[model samples]
Target chain A: MINKTINQKAWFMVLPVLALVAFNAIIPLMTVVNYSVQETFGDNLFFWEGLKWFEEVMRSERFHDALGRQLLFTLLILLIEVPLGVGIALTMPRQGIGVTICLVLMALPLLIPWNVVGAMWNIFALPDIGLLGKMLNGVGFDYNFTQNTFWAWATVVAMDVWHWTSLVVLLCYAGLRSIPDAYYQASKIDGATSWQVFRYIQLPKMKRVLTIALLLRLMDSFMIYTEPFVLTGGGPGNSTTFLSIDLVKVALGQFDLGPAAAMSIIYFLVVLLLCWVLYTLMMRNETN
Target chain B: MSSITLKSLRHSYLQNPQSEEDYALRKIDLTWRDGGAFALLGPSGCGKTTLLNLISGLLKPSEGQILFDDSDVTSLPPDQRNIAQVFQFPVVYDTMTVYDNLAFPLRNRKLPEAELDERVQRVAKMLSMQNQLKHRASGLTAADKQKISLGRGLVRSDVNVMMFDEPLTVIDPHLKWELRSQLMRLHQQVGFTMIYVTHDQTEALTFADEVVVMYEGQIVQIGTPEELFLKPRHTFVGHFIGSPGMNILPCDWNDGGAVFAGHQISLNGNLSNPASTSKLQLGIRPEFIRLASEGIPARIQRVDDVGRYRIIKAEVGGTSLNIYANEEVEIPSDSLHLDFDPDHTHVYCDGWIHEAKGQS
Candidate 1:
């Protein structure tokens, strides 16, 4: 058995964090749980309506649409980001001053706040004064993101790719850098073509880091609120109203407390289930 | 089927080499005979691995040409050179089975399944890895993984040459000997041209038919193990090749013999290049230094009891020297006399050994 006294000291160090987590997370979670089961009115009257709100949410089309949007956005984000990021990373230099310059440029996009990213892209795609919009028009293209549903969706997806592909690039670059020079030497000696080297060596070696990037991108894309909220306002007949935006709309916009609280709980469970599945699959592959 | 030759090879990390000081590999000219087991041996940063990389076509030389069987291949990439290399660390496809790992190159070349299986099984049996064929490479020990790497390199029989860059570094000490012997056996069976690079003297000496000793980006000497030990062409080679290394003592040369710290030792033969000497020194192996009743007086410092033999370290005229003797020999407590075997001793001048006059 491990020495209990050594571990006892660790609890002392972790106590403050535990208390902070309990105050910030557990307390709010308990409140959500209480609200999930109880119905309330303006006079603070509570009526026990256990599982009724949950049943109603389970049958709601709005909940289904939001969940579907969230899943599709996450899938789209992963499909675009991973390949684009890996390509950019592979094209970057292995060493010298060029590598440092490339790393700093890639990191610049990530340092900008998410809300600012949304605002910046919103202005940049305005179709009249914005540089990208003017350029697109100059090329004799009809582009009005705010008015067109397809254009609005394209703008959001493109903006997300610009903001998040950098993250994947940085992670993969680090993974690539950590590979020993000896492996490259071995590959060279084996007469491996460029594609063979990338397929058999680089891909397998980048597995763990790719899994991490995939999980982070999936979770963030699923829960994304600020960018789409600010960029499109879920406009053009809810073309981009993701789950988080819809949840907020119900909780604060419509103020239907019981249904919104129930939806929030279900939202949390969906994210948890997806994250658990992703983690399990990644860990199983790593172990084998 | 091919012999590799380096013609006036020179390299430097700096773009322009202003002088002799700027080169990493100075104008080296050498050749490896076809189907020869050759080794480039030296201490760390002595340009042994650099020369190996140049031969393997991983590094392009700043000057000179590399020819394979008289075909100029200096500018070719490693893939175009048709050579197999095993690195210092094990580099195997971790997700593939041992059999698949060995068969990857053959499969890439579009060989038939029957031929691939035959070659893989043959190489695996040579490496004593036949039983691990079905198991994934990820679960094996480091040595076993290294064996798979070796098998991968050896399985392709059509390659012009095979190069090993310190391949046994990760192996356990006890297992190194067995692996070295197995490599020798494999070479004998296959008769492929091989160039082994290492810093370990024992591995180089025991494994290679021709050992090229390198120092400071230059080939100091290239010979068999016996020639390297018995006739080191440079002082660095003298200091590098032996166990505990050869003893080098500064001496003044006269007409008949050399004098060290006022003690005159008679010469076994006349000096070859007697008139051309500037600075001279005496070089002798510790194995040739005998502890005797009367000779050069020495102060005994320490004795190390290695299993089969004892190493006696002593100071003679303020210069430290080591003597290896049988464990049965009892050392005297206070002081001892050292005698140099004249036939085994060499006279070095200006960092090069001098042959007796009229002998060359």
Candidate 2:
């Protein structure tokens, strides 16, 4: 073994990155922590609340309803988008000019700004003038979304699928493209049906990308606010109000900052915990 | 098992091919008997793999038909062709166990579970993979993965032809020789028609009974290993099949003999009505030329000692020539000469060997 010199100044190189992260994430997070444990009025006067807000937010029936609605929305979109995305990607052409055309078409929806997507669908699903709404009502169904809770939920879900399914399609397409041609040739020579080829060859190869698509859609659909807020404004009663929309109604709309801050922290923790659990589950299967 | 035949087969990747250069595989008409081990030997971009794919029905020929023992199969898909192809890379199913990977082809045909298990077990045993049958295929080594791919073909009972497209390319060098011999042994035991495509001369010459040498999308020659060495039908075969290749010398046809560097050299056969307009050259393997006391005079330029023999590079009238001499042979310092073995030397018109009269 050779004698090696250790430098004490090497740690200085990491200071800038730490400082940048502290300002961007850690400092803002600490303000939320500060608000969660205390109460404040318009004058910035504070009083120790001692976990009272956490208790209130945890026990609130409104919070439970919002959480349930968020979970259901995430589950619904994930069920619809992931399979639909994978199906579209599977049917896309694998080569030639058609590949370029299909890829560009898939990427079109993802290129729109999130708020623009929300605003565009808000008008696009209008009952009287919009093509989709007029056609639905014209086909002999009473499909007005402004006052109906079911139609409101349906419109929001459809808008989210239309705006976000393209992302999953592109991700799964990249994964599908990475597979070697030999696998397909071998499967063909093995006399596998199309379903068997998908089950044995395509699915296993797309697992990594599908995991990414799931996590992204799960988190995005959970924190969904812009599209549904613009489309239904949490509906005529509160049926469409998800966790973020509920938290916003409390924090900004109703000015209940203490409970709202606590709710925000809880929401962040839920997303983090859910993503961690899902990533661990997926990676565990991969290693085995 | 069936004898394969290709009748005027041609293929082009372009939708509208106007010239011969547009064809990836030029017109080919050939046949192979059942249970014959043949190798398509060529350098890269020589359409060996294209020919293999056309035979296996992965690609349909742009023109003409492919026959498996006199039945046209040009329009059939690869699955319906009843063929198996091991690719250049290992194509095992990663999520499957070794046993499942082998059983896949048989199970797809809905063979009874009892027969499927028996066939899988037989193939696993033959590949020496019986102990790893329960192991996941992705967890195995590269060579083991390749063996699993090969085992997949072996488990199928109805496969008429087993094609290999340079299956040893991804294998380690030490494992390559072992896998090659195992393939030869497997071919002998099963006695199926095997067509191996490769660019490596040693692999092709050793694995195949009759090596089909190809160049620029055309089959140059098809002959046994000894025949290729002794009598290469094309100049490309003479250059491609041997180590350090055969030596070619530009010559002129003078009085029915090849005149090379002011020396009249006799050929293996009699020349009849040679084309005066076509270019002519003399071809001889380095092994067939030796240092002589009385022949075409040459000056020794350099000597490469290849352990067993020394390749003597000499200059004759401004042209370079290579001769092989044994390690113990003495080299004359002054006035060195070289002699060509008439039985092995041949004259070529253009790129092809001239089919002179009185030859076998």
Candidate 3:
């Protein structure tokens, strides 16, 4: 055999990253994995639950209802925010002092704490004295979020859109600015109408950024709990009790750790699966 | 086909221009004849792009009337002016295929589908890009994208004028010659009025029938390549148009000859100095200076071999001068005498050529 020299020491460079992941993500995940397979009754006493908790959570109607509500909220907000964000970005002034002003104002909502956002909306939609409530009542509509299921759902959806749409706007605005002036000039010379320019030039250029915005909004909306928990507290007959709020109720409130852990794994897998499918579909046209 | 005229064209990027120096294009009045090939040759920051944009209707001139076939079109936009322009970097739609890119102009005009397809195929074949028309433009090389931009300009038969603003700046070195010759062949075949703007002398001299040389926001000279090489109308043209540019030397003038460094050089005609505050000097190309048996004595300084010719740097008076020696010529170590061609030499006053009284 021909002589060959090989060094196995390069594998050491990955040990540090492996250690960090073990502490930060893998170890915690394995703890949940352990708790998911067994039942704990008291100190130093355990029983093998096997697949019992998974079966129970899958058969529960509460889980199904919460999952349904979560899906509807995610779909509705995405439908509203992505297009509304892009429209606002299009109308925003391209440069000068106006750009700075609009960007700062758009960013104001995203910077507030989630609970604070929920609390602020809680007061702002109060039936008696809240500005929105008073305006709606003044316009002859019955609009009390605390007492009606439909109003609770609407208020929660509205709150998420107001809080998250600016993230999409900033991303889209950055994408629009990177396009060179030559594209517009060339299209002008080619006699393209404004609609044609937007359809061909602007939309195609914005596809990548828009994909990222969509994925981020989808994942965050799926895991949303703090804002709705603070505002509606999963109330008005459980109309807005999304998956996270339901998970917290079963885990901490009802003391059902095994079922909660099983549900958590299922929820994480759903988000991961959906994001992978959506990203693959959106990036289908790119050559690479 | 239509001739274009720019009348009293002036432009300033400033909101309020107070003086002539504030204008980017300072009062240019010129014409491009129908069915002519012209090049705007200038260095950077010379308002060449500004003038091209004005003609293409990208920028309205602050003060001028832009005329196409004697119609006033100063206020019109680029589409209304029927102008087509290719930028320095190729501006192709990345999402479109090469076929669709070529068909863009015609499609925008709502041409019949059959006619549009025919025109796109014709231009693609002319540019030798017919086979690659099915490929995406973003996936192609820079040269291929630029060919598509050129094809887009050629696809429209109704364009009043076609302009190129340094279109080959991004092309590979070997590909530049091929693209230039392709453009030349297209010009000869189509006979469309073309305006090419470039800072490189070779591209300008090879591409155009007439070269418009510019300097500092104003056009300094317009002539054939031969005329620009032999007799430059402006000192900047003489310095800018040739390899190793023209050499200029200061001298003391007498009635019939000039003296520099204790040598008397005879003049071919009666020439005198101008009385303006501008300096006057003798301008001669490096090719016209020769080493002879008896002439102005000078100390040979250094020699540089440039393959075909040896450039001899010699010091005569207080100035350094460059002279081209034939490759086969032997070097004289310490002593050298240089001769000037009196017929080709001219005096420049204030950066412009002063005509010799005896010649045109």
Candidate 4:
């Protein structure tokens, strides 16, 4: 018989982390809960408003519209980024100086601060004087992004794609490179076509990393705020207002603290639930 | 069925290989006849895999040409060479089922449905994987996965040759015999040219009709298993083949007399000696060393009883030698006269066998 001694000393190693979480996550979360079920105007005056903010936020058309736009944006980019990232990664060189150059170029947009990225695009796409705006106007198209709803949405989506597709490319490239040379050799001996090799070998090997890329892109896109907020200020007729932007507007602009807290909680729960579903679906067939 | 011929084939990974050491595979001009079972037996860095890859067209030779039955396939790729190569590790599509894995090659070529099914079922049944046909390939054990790899190679009956690079390296010891016998039976049934590479002597001896022993990127000897044991052309073969290996003793040749430990030993025939100052050694298997009434004196060092026989480790003039004796024989304690069978003992000059006069 084997004997395992009971050791209570290991709990000391995790106490700091527990204290940190209590200070950081749990306390702030409790504050949000307190504000969600109560109302306060000033001077510590509070009134009990049980679930009123939650009910109002759920019924509001503005919240639904923001969620719909967020979903559309996420869906459109995912549909574009995944395959496009994979295609670009496949075409990327496996080795040499060109790899460093390509990676640096792709990472340039990601390295820029969110505000700077928004400002850069704003000035680049301004109707009167910006380079892209002047070029589009010179090309004889009405391409004023601040006034046109279609152009505003297009510019925001395009900016996000430009900013984040490199992440997908790098992840998928790592996944593609992880496959052993033996598989390619055996496939060659088996007379496998190039497409067959991609389908049966490369794609299955990349599935894990691609899943990670999808989850990251989905969560980040769902909660996007800084770039589009700076670019169009969720304007051009609220066309680019996503969930986080709407939450910020309600919290800071209107000072609707109770409704904002309720909306924030719901937004967090939606991201958690959607991410859980995506993870569960992706990992279902992994077990033996 | 095809007869593969390698004409002055050499390979080097370097861009400008100037010397013999730069070449991964030395000048290898050899022929593997149709439907022959051959094994490239060597150690880890002996260039056997390089030769196998060259034959399969996975690697093109840096110089010379490779011909498959008079067709120069020097620059052809592995796909067009019509050969199947089983890698050291099993390579199967992880997402596909066992049946689909077997059917992959046939489907790639757009074979008819009934024919593809028949081939897949036939190969699966050959590998005893019929029950696992629907299971995912990734869920199988290492041995079964390797069997699926072999099945994939064999399912395509049109492949002119099949190459195995250490196929049984991952198999359990007890199951290796089973799989080897299965492979032998399959070879007899299929009758396609097969080239197997391994560092294990037992695997090479058991699976191949002709074992091509390689050392340092060169072919040392190519012969049947019996010939490899009886008359190893190089000292490397003699040392690498037998269990507990052959005993190689440094000796001297003075006026055509083979002298060991200040005593003269007579062999079966005369040696075509190299330079008198050059090095020479007496190579003999432990089985041929016998207890004699009067021979070279040696002291008994240790004796190990390994079930059927006893391995007597002894020292003679600062050199250690192993002798495999029957369990019934009495072991000498202090000193013993060790005799070498004249018919089996031979002289090696600078590692190569010095062929006796008028003997092939």
lDDT measured at residue A5 in model 1 versus the true structure, 0 to 100? 52
Which is superior by lDDT, 1 or 4?
4
Candidate 2, residues A80-116, lDDT tens digits: the string is 9999999999998998899999988888888888788
For candidate 4, what is the interface RMSD?
A: 0.9
- Tens-place lDDT per residue, model 3, B206-294, is 99999999999999998999989888988899999888888888866655566666677766767765654667777888889899888
DockQ scores of the candidates? 0.63, 0.79, 0.73, 0.78
Q: Which runs in model 2 stand beyond 4 Å of their true positions?
A: A1-7, B299-302, B331-335
Q: Summarize candidate 1's per-residue lDDT along B135-202 as a digit string, tens digits.
A: 98888988898888888878887788988989999999999988888889889988999999999999
Point out where model 4 deviates above 4 Å.
A1-13, A96-112, A123-134
Candidate 2 CA-lDDT value: 0.90
TM-score of each: 0.95, 0.96, 0.94, 0.94
On TM-score, the leading prediction is 2
Which scores higher on TM-score, 1 or 4?
1
Winner on DockQ between 1 and 4 is 4
Model 3 clashing residue pairs (backbone): none
Candidate 3 chain B: worst 10 consecutive residues by lDDT?
Answer: B269-278
Candidate 1 docking quality: incorrect, acceptable, medium or high: medium
Q: Judged by DockQ relative to the true structure, which candidate is superior, 3 or 4?
A: 4
